[model samples]
Target: DASRIAIRHGLPNSAALPIAQHKDYDRMFADIRDKLHAKSGDPVKPEHLE
Candidate 1:
């Protein structure tokens, strides 16, 4: 998860961390909307992201 990445690499909360790089948070966050969108069928607002 992005939260875990923030703790693992020690990145600040504001950091988005490159999505095309790592295989964890980077990968998850990259397709968060697409994945969640399939199940929820919404706009996937920022606050709604996990």
Candidate 2:
């Protein structure tokens, strides 16, 4: 998904995105993980997912 964002924004690669953008991507991933965890009723913490 980060790669897709990079490509969509014409970045050379995912690493080329700015730090803020990188964090945004990370947060997006975390949110998705949270949703999945919620559905499965897992007890894992968000920070552990990172």
Candidate 3:
């Protein structure tokens, strides 16, 4: 199932997640936020989100 899902998504089989352990969602979100900030020159502060 994992391999099939990966192939359907055009990703390597290794990209599939294991059943035992999951990924760090918070860290992933933070990394995405940082990348977006770097590319957009947008402020990430609470006051700036308004």
lDDT (CA) per prediction: 0.62, 0.68, 0.61
- TM-score top scorer: 2
Candidate 3: where is the Cα deviation over 4 Å? 1-23, 38-50
Give the lDDT of residue 11 in candidate 3: 71
On residues 1-50, what C-alpha lDDT tens digit does candidate 3 reach at each position?
87788679987565354522446765675676785564344456665455
The residue ranges of model 2 lying beyond 4 angstroms of the native Cα positions read 1-21, 38-50
Candidate 1, residues 25-49: lDDT per residue as tens digits? 7566558756666444555667565
RMSD each, Å: 9.4, 9.6, 9.6
TM-score of each: 0.24, 0.35, 0.29
The runs of at least 3 residues in candidate 1 whose Cα sits more than 4 Å from the true structure, single-residue gaps closed, are 1-21, 36-50
State in Å the error of residue 34, model 2.
Answer: 0.2
**lDDT, candidate 2, 1-50, per-residue tens:** 87778678876773564764777877886787777665344576767657
**Model 2 TM:** 0.35
Decide which is better by TM-score, 1 or 3: 3
Residue 20, model 3: lDDT of 25
Clashes of 2: 0
